[model samples]
Target: MKKDQNDRDSAIIIPFPGLKDRYYEKGISSLESHHFQEAVDFLKQAYQMDSTDPHISAAYLAALYENGNYDDSKRMAEELLKSGIGSFYDVLDIYLMILIQLNDYKQVVATLKPLFEENEIPPEKAEHFLQLLKLSEKAVRNQVMENSPKDDIPFLHQEQSPQDQLIGLGMLKDKNIHPYLDSLIEMLSVEKVHPFIKTAILSLFKENKIDQSILVEKLGKKETLNPMDIPSAEEFPFFHLVKNQMESQLRDHNPVLLEQILDMIERHSLCLYPFEWEPTNPSVWTAAYRAMGYELYGENWNLEKLAEFHSVQEAELGTIFTFIVKLEEISSAIVSPQ
Candidate 1:
């Protein structure tokens, strides 16, 4: 897909003898195609050849920004501004954007206020800058309020437990939290830690899209297997029978069978009503159905509608659905009270 024209325009292309034209063209093509990593790779080559070229630097910065490498992008933008190579307003715009993503609101205010006072902002961009300025000021105020000292007497103050502190730290929105993530992860991985605290830490990592394989290993759990590798109904006679019955009902389009399968699932405690599960062992089909069902219906689930929304063929959906049911049954049986 072609990137928006504004993004293309934001990639300022200054010419330099050292960097080959072909590299610049390839970099721009990758950026247009929305292949950000490829764009970064190409643009970095072009940049190394001629670091002084504003156009090359800008394109590299944009690629870094697109790839969520805000720190690198910010550094490149600052370098460009310091060198006085690119259009000042353009470099400042990219710098401001990086600051916003990094949540350095105070720096944003500091950076923009001078530009605004000096009337350096172009007419078209003035309003956008003003909006960003206002937002930065508000964020700064909110940060002050969040960090303000409380007036409560020391004798009356209740101390938070280590687990509560971990949870609170995980929930904080400050950019300074980076310095503490490793320590928090270490604390969270201790086997003696409360399960709920471990869960909270895991959730925080998941929410930020951070890899948790290290923490997973530290917990002494077996490595997560590919869903396809998990044993299914073929290994369990009772589950196979249940699967056959569900398939027969689905083949007939008998909606009543939905309730029967749900009842079986509930009895086995394989899945909670409304279909939620930990992201652990299960067949691919089971995981797919659960994810699609949750996204479509959330807690208020409707299986038939979910199947329809995904345009799932009757046979395929039914097979997957039954497989999930059987998978859940096996899972519950393994963990159930003896």
Candidate 2:
């Protein structure tokens, strides 16, 4: 439960730790030594201390590019150039370096042509800049970044989220959501789409109070969703409904048992998200409580008592419990111990 909660909260950006004056020398030294990670770690703090300091910003930008944080480097470079952090020429050079590394040759060609035409380039660096412009022109001529078959994966969680589809979802936030409904529906219909991406789509729909009908599928289950009526992530299905039912059964009698059961519900919710344990029966998870209580805690959670309380047949509950054990195992594998 705690681990899953933390994952949901990971979206909040964490800035670099504070640094005192003169500490950026440490970062400069790291950059000189080619220890890119150490350089980013140290210089970002110095950059935070005084973003106006061109020397610190330039070193940090170099570190980020070398560390393969092209997105961060790209953003920093754009800011420096747009705002004239110190000198337009100096920042423009770093910005071009980042764009080349990202293979955004189109942007490189677009940016440099104007600069060269206006005689903006320094004589000493003009030849070097011209070579980059020609290189990018070649790639752009080949139509790179234009005819790519897949979406551009975001820099955040690029290892797991290899495609940039999530950016589409982010764009939908606070929008009408009607114009893009067809695009979203098509994305969901593709079988190759990742579960995490699909979850983000539905969660966004639910968050924005969407009223449209959309088809949703998982494992082998399929349903038409009207997200306006369902629970959002804040009021997650299990935590909203089944949790109250289970608590009613316990009647505040055993804090330890209640805690253990809530943990199971949270784990199951995390494992099965964008979906929840359904039929929303108190008996199903009440039965889970009875079984896991025995298996994990060595307590005799009477099956007959649980069945009687929930007004379900013991035989049927046992059958459901049989599948629950397998489901529980799969759920455990997804939520590794933190």
Candidate 3:
């Protein structure tokens, strides 16, 4: 059984039994040559042949991210972290670069918090994270100011202890948590929160908090969405999964293709498709449709289009929603076809 599994796991080649050292060297060489995809494939083979090859797996993850295999890359990174090996820190260091490109600040913060808690970070490494956190803090603030300020509050982790809170809050406050501003108010409301922390948070919130009723009126309150309707990232498909499906739909535009796309939108609880329609590559038409907010997640949709499509039947929404479900379900079924 062991021999059969090993044979099955080995990378196929003309000779049928490729030397492990040769494949490992080739993968490293491919990475140096900037052949990211080829390097990923070869490194993956080396990984399978010897799961102990920590360096190979790290290199594979780098190549995977560079080659735009974000899902696999992320999975590999997470697997390394969870596998309880010292090498995962090295993998995470490289994975952070990809997260930066994806604008995934929340994940970066989450990943950083663990290392901070463990006090495992060196000064040079700590400085790099600090710089990234600064950029992320600014980006998040701009996003809130330009768009939905209320929505951004959810990204704040209320469960964090005072020490963990200080590191993240310091980043959020841009290193000057002084003089108390309205921004910190929401941070104070939690029960059992430290008095010092509460004082700091209360000062910020009091400064920023406007009259809720008046603000709502000024914003033109109509039918407000239930807070329960908000979609969390954890509840949706991985961003790359939606991106892959949307790209597939774009590559072939027909009613059948459109149906496939709509199916994907519906299945992922209407969240994944929103980001999917808007990819990193703007040259693709999917980005245009996504930018138009055709398949926005629960909310954060463009107002003009929302009005135009508001009266559109809920059944259509159901159809699209189920299409996504069907896509996931069907794909899984096929993989384990009965």
Q: Specify the highest-TM-score model's number.
A: 2
TM-score of 1: 0.40
lDDT winner between 2 and 3, please give it: 2
| After superposition, candidate 1 runs with Cα above 4 Å error | 1-19, 144-338
Assess each prediction's global lDDT (C-alpha) against the native: 0.56, 0.65, 0.50
Candidate 2: lDDT over CA atoms?
0.65
Q: Give the local distance difference test score of model 1.
A: 0.56
lDDT for each residue of candidate 1 in 256-311, tens digit (9 for 90 to 100): 43334434443342222112233222333343344333443445655566556544
lDDT of 3 by residue, 152-228 (tens): 43224555444334334433443233332244444433444443344334333334442232110101112222223
Candidates by lDDT, descending order: 2, 1, 3
Which pairs in model 2 have colliding backbones? 153-164
Error of 2 at 273 (Å): 6.2
- Candidate 3 accuracy as TM-score: 0.38
Summed over model 2, clashes come to 1
TM-score of each: 0.40, 0.42, 0.38
